[model samples]
Target: MEHRVVLVTGGSSGIGKSIGIYLKSKGFKVYGTTRRLDSHPNFTDFELLELDVRNPESIGFAIARLMEREGRLDVLINNAGIGITGPIEETPHSEILKAFDTNFNGPIHMSKAVLPHMRRQEKGLIINITSIAGYMGLPYRGFYSASKGALELVTEALRMEVKGFGVNITNLAPGDFATNIASGRYHAPILSDSPYKEPYGNTLKMMNEHVDSGKDPMLVAQMVFKIINTKNPKVHYKVGEFMQKFSLFLKKILPDKVYEKLLMNHYKL
Candidate 1:
């Protein structure tokens, strides 16, 4: 029996890399994507391919190359995304657009590129790595949350659309993970004289500190493997510490204003 082929976007480092390696250990033939082949990190087990999710041509090319060789893409992990931090009012329009492009639109593009093949196979899984922020807005990270929320909605709609083809899809929302995402994160320029600078700086500081102390990326990888082993996956899976994952549950049950106050209070706003 042949091992199923898995493709993970943004696999050079962080969660993507962890998922790729973990899946490989489980006997899956995994291929991870980096924006540039030359920039791929020192990954030993799985193969690497060049893929820039923001570019449709690149997405198409990457999937095409994989299809040409594997003849089947059993699983696609849309794990590539970027983080931008700053006040919504102060963030550059271009920066916000870029966030949506890479986070939301990129997954859509990749999904579209791979769907036809998955449809042909009549069995496939697409796991999208979203964030807990998608459930509610976060200060200084509004656009990131917005982008993730948008993609979650897309996943919800797409799942209904693709069920007939035997394609399984789910949005995996991670609370926080100790990863290189902060180092590669895009920070908007905070002018010294800007009114929002003080709060923005404080919020950004808190956010990074939270992530620094967050759950291990391997935990998420393990969750991904579990999801794969299941015959029928859920529409959403939240992986992280109790509070982080439970907050979403709270939001669902609490009144809007109460939840808003709780969220604001937690962030020290």
Candidate 2:
């Protein structure tokens, strides 16, 4: 088989970095994008591209550069996103916009930019990195969940829309992965004083604790490779241990009230 050319956004660190490295190890020509190009840790074989997914021009420029050099893009991974922790009411509008721009719109723009090329070739794969929160709502993570949930829907729609063109779209919903995702390094809006301050505060604390104990990002990267290599991959792939099972089961058998109660108890709400 011919080696595939893969592009991963937010590849400077965490799951994106792991995927880029893993794909390179498997002999794929991998190009990784990062907002902070200078800060990206040096990876021997992968190409690093500076891309701000929120900017349409940036995404276009990056894709143009890649296509100019590589001639074709076989796989595009939309993994650049930010995590915000706050109650829906307390979260500022600007923060919500930022989340949507990065999480949802970014992927949409990237997909659009690459589609012409993919369609012309009549073969390609698009992998979207969403979250378990996309499948199950979490306390104090409403904004984040909403953003990811939107991406989930987009992925599903795109999958069917591109089927005739031989393009596959897969959504990867990972539970908690060990990464700097909760470190507030990406971007966030200022918190405001509100009536539900205590619950919001407590929720943020709980989120930090849970994220600190999350699974290795390498596991997620491995799953990405598996999905891409498969001749016919599933529309959705869930990673992680407990969260994965819980999300799947809750969506299938649990009642809304029961699921809500379990979530509240888990988060000490």
TM-score of each: 0.97, 0.93
Per-residue lDDT of model 2, residues 79-99, tens digit only: 988988766775678878888
Clashing pairs in 1: none
Candidate number with greatest TM-score:
1
lDDT of each: 0.92, 0.85
Estimate the overall C-alpha local distance difference test score of candidate 1.
0.92
Clashes of 2: 0
Runs off by more than 4 Å, candidate 1 = none
Candidate 1 worst ten-residue window by lDDT: 36-45
TM-score for candidate 1: 0.97
RMSD of each: 1.1, 2.1
- Residue 172 in model 2: shift from native, Å? 0.6
